[model samples]
Structures are given as C-alpha cells and as structure tokens.
Target: MTSAPVDQQDSLAAWLSIRTTVPWPRWSGERAAAGPPAADGVRDYFTATRGDRDPEGTARVLTALDRALADAQEGRQLNFALLTGWQRYVLHRDPVGFRTLPAFAKGGRERYGLAADTAARFEQCLSQSTQPDLPLPSRAARTYLDVLFFHPFEDGNARAAMLALAFVLACDGACLDQAHPLQVTRWADDADGAADLAVLIGILISATQRRQRHRSPA
Candidate 1:
C-alpha cells in the first residue's frame, strides 16, 4: 500500500499545542548570568548545552552564528560569505559549501531545492525579509522556512536554519525560550507547512516574551 498521508497542518498544530503547554526548558547558568538575553548569550547557552552533540562542529557553528547575528542586526544582508563561513564551520574539513550537486532529504520525500544558480536570488529574498516592513516573528519564521526549502547548505541545513531563525529573533531584541520546535522534521512540499510554521513562530514569540517577563526581576 502507498504510505499514509501526512496532515501538515494537524501535525504542526499538535506540536505547537504540546510545546506551549510544557514549561520552557530551564536556562543554563551561562544564559542566566548573561544579564540580558542576546544573540551571543543564546549562542553561549546553546554551545554549552549542545556542544557535545557535534563536538567537532559546534564551536564553529556557534562562532559563525555570533558573527552572522552581529551583521544582521546592523541591517546587513545575508550573502555568500556569511553562509560559506557558517558551512565551513558546520562541515569542518568538508570542502563543500552550497551543494553544487543535487541534495536529498529524509529519503528524498520532497522535490529538489532551487537550482544552484538561484542561490544569489535566494539570498536576496532572505535579505528582503529582514526589512523593517515585516514583523520580526514573520521574518524569523519565514527565514526558517526559506532555509528549509532552499536547503542552502549540503549538510547541517537544519542547524543552520535554527541559527538563522534565532538570529532573526535576537536581532529584533527578543530571544526564543527554546529552539527545539524548529528542529522537528518537515517536508517542503506540504501545502500548509509554511503557514503552520508561521503559527508556531508566533506561539514561540509569545512564549519567549512570557519567559522574559517571568525571568526578569521586579
């Protein structure tokens, strides 16, 4: 029999429901000690908690993320240098940056990503999203979705996307309580996937705001 269908909206809705009900994970001592949550503080917490998950690459991605956030906060546009720098760190010794060859995901469930030549155009779209016209939550959510669909890097695109989303939030003077929601599996072809993610993003934004309020001293 053919594989059962995936209900993209239902899947995201359920995930969002459960996530919002739970307590946001406790902040690490490093994060708590950072005075106020910022991009570097988030990186510090992420690196401390998660560094061992990919011992060889965590430092690099963390460093690159800090750099990218610094630039993005100044209204700088994303370009090849920023991305390749991140890839170099995430991939370590691997020479590949953007996949010149085709890429696949989860056994090739979705269609191929944009053509290699469209990478510049992809960067343009990403940059445009950061304009003040768009809400930060929408920009962050859309950036995460863009990274999911663009598949910009050969490896570690998911991680990169998480960082990208976090950066967008941090740049807007907010920090997510957790980045785990973006780590869930996704399919580019799902019609409701992008919209659902936007909903999740809004939930995350509100959750983070509450978290900040609760954590702050009176």
Candidate 2:
C-alpha cells in the first residue's frame, strides 16, 4: 500500500540498487550473463528448458521456489534453488522471466549510495505483506516481491527489489508492466530514489486491468 509518486530527486537510495553495462551478473561465468543479447550460456539454458507449459510441472516448479525460500529463511543455502526457479519459470511461462533478478557483480559500487540502506529497506518490505486493505499495483509489477525480502543477491539490488514487487503482482492476479527502457534510463539518470513508487504502482495496476478486461476467461 503506502502508494505514491517516487521522490525522483531524493530516491538516490533506490537508484543505487540497479546494474549498468560493465561487470555483469555474478553468475555470468558460472551460469550466464545478464542484459540484452544474453550470453551463449543463457541461450543454451533457454534452449534446454524450452517446452510446453505443463501445468503440473509449473506447480512443481513453484513449490520448489516455496521450499527454497523456506530453506533460505531457515539458514540453508538457497542460491541454487533461487536460480533454478528463475530458469525453469522462464521455460514454463515467459511472463515469469520479467521477474528474474540478476546476480551481483563484483566490487559493489553505488552510483546512488544506497548500500547502507538496501538491507534495511528490504527488511521493511518483508515485514509488510500486501494486505487486502493495502491496495497494490498490477500482478506483474508486484511479482518482484521475492527479491525484496529474499535479498537473494548483492549487486543487482534494485532489480531484485522491483522483481519482488513484480512477483507479488503476478501471484495476486494483478498485471505487471515490465519497466520500459526509457523509464529505466530516466530513473537511472536520477540515480536517486527520486522515482515515485506509488505512481508506478498505480500505472502498472491500471495497465494490467485494461489488458485483463479484453482477454477471454481461462
């Protein structure tokens, strides 16, 4: 809930959480790279998992994620589980790909100086679930909820945060509007939490509702 426009000028902390062109995801060599025209490893992974969406398979995949989260919260190693979840979900449903959180790059530098607060904000988000009384954005926008509380990675903190929100939206029947490159660039320019969270949430919600209205019922 706590919806409202982001403080573009003051949101430096928010801006510091994302990634740039150099020194990509931490998993690049171990897995694949992040960004457009992904690495060969990424293409190969996608090729391997590409298949029809088996509802059962999807359910199992989701169950695995739940298990992974539980294990993580209980002090178990969950990097594999989280990475696997994103990979398999990408195979089962393209929509899920929008929620992917890139691994951290080395030398955690901050263009926006948010390192001190990333964990704090993430913890704050985890404490508050999206309650009925708390209006939310579209499903897609909300799906990234996982990354917010999970703190699954260190470098791509912002991506993780948004991904967490996107995940929440998807699961709650709200539509998600993957951030537009233009919008991202603009926000990047701010390099501050200057962006308005509430405004973005509202936009995502409205866009998703409009799209859902026209789709035939499943």
Candidate 3:
C-alpha cells in the first residue's frame, strides 16, 4: 500500500518550525511584536502567540490558518472568528458575517454585504485558480494579494496569508520561508498599519527571486 502525502500542517511545520523549540532569532520574532500596531503602523498583524506552558498542550496555530483559508475558499461568511491573544490572532478583514463575503482583505470590511456575497462567491467559482498567469514566483505574488483581499481571519491574517501562499508555492516545490527570519519579519513589520498586501507582495517577489535562483538548475 502506498502512503498518502503529508497534510498542509506537517508541511508548514516542517518548513516553518511551527510549534517547535528551535532557537528563534532575537529579532524578527512575533513574540516580541504583538498587540497594538507597530509605530511604523504595520497594517496587518503577523503575531505568534505561543504559550508559556499554558493550558492547550500543543497549539495548532498553523491548523487554524489552514481552516481559515479553507473557510474563505468555501465561500462561507464568518462573524465568529477566534481572535485570541495567543497564536498570532488578528483579524485581516472585519465583519465578515454569514451574509457578507467582501474582497479587499484589510480595507474591505463590510458590516452588511449583499445577500449574494460576491467575493467569496467568486473565489468559490474559480477552478484551477491556484495556477497563476506568471511563473510560479508571480503566482505566489497573486495569492498573497488575493487572500489579503479576502481577509478571512480575525487575527494572524498576514501569517495565514503567507502560509496559504507558501502552500501553493510548495505545490511547485518552491518555499518562501527559506528566506531568513529577519527578511520575513521585515515584511511582517512592513504591514501598512493595516497589513498591506502590496508591501507583502514586494517582499514575496524578492523572496521568490531568491528562491528561484537558489533552486535554479545548476
């Protein structure tokens, strides 16, 4: 019998050291940067709320991210997002009720969306949407933009957005987190005091170029 491929959680943990005890860098740490937006006004929040031996034995923050992405894809509206202080929780877009599904992630916060909820509807309607027009790198760029537009989660929107994009690139054997933690943190800190997808797109573009060169055929 053939073994099934590993799920997204394992892959993300493997690449990202999710829920690990590895020596994290002093800087570029979500632990150091949480609560109130940075002075620079990092738009979106990219926090990591690991507990200090707290209740939930092993927090599956990555899993939460996976669910949020899937939920957004499912065209389901969610008003009851889990916005916890632990585990990098911060809503991307806001007020995504079961009735509304707006696009434009951070800026697109609609208290009352059309009964038909177009954005989520469009996402659900898409087929092979994962495949991008540009090379894998550009495709990666688009995913960051699209999810940021969706803004599914109430917290950890950027991290979740980055993870979702990472999953797609990994499908093509390209990983973004290969960039240094400082690099990733730079992008996180660069959130436009609202988690600007455009800034993150720039970061992803640079990382993709590096990854392409690194993985280039010798």
Which candidate tops TM-score?
1
Could you tally the backbone clashes for each prediction? 0, 40, 20
Candidate 3: misplaced stretches above 4 Å? 1-58, 63-115, 119-128, 153-156, 178-218
lDDT of 3: 0.35
Q: Rank the candidates by TM-score, best first.
A: 1, 3, 2
C-alpha TM-scores of all predictions: 0.70, 0.37, 0.38
Candidate 1 lands at a TM-score of: 0.70
Cα lDDT of model 2 by residue, 1-218, tens digit: 12222332323334334422112111101111122121122122222333254445435444433443344345432232344354444334332322222222212221222354454554444434344444444222222323432333432333334434434543444433334421332333231222244446565455444454445344
Where does model 2 exceed 4 Å of error? 1-121, 131-133, 138-152, 181-195
Determine the backbone clash count of candidate 1: 0
The full ranking of all candidates by lDDT, starting with the best, is 1, 2, 3
Candidate 2 CA-lDDT value:
0.35
The TM-score of predicted model 2 comes to 0.37
The candidate with the higher lDDT, 2 or 3, is 2
Q: What lDDT score belongs to each candidate, Candidate 1 first?
A: 0.59, 0.35, 0.35
The residue pairs found clashing in candidate 1 are: none
Name the regions of candidate 1 deviating beyond 4 angstroms: 1-35, 38-53, 93-96, 113-116
What is the total number of backbone clashes in candidate 3? 20
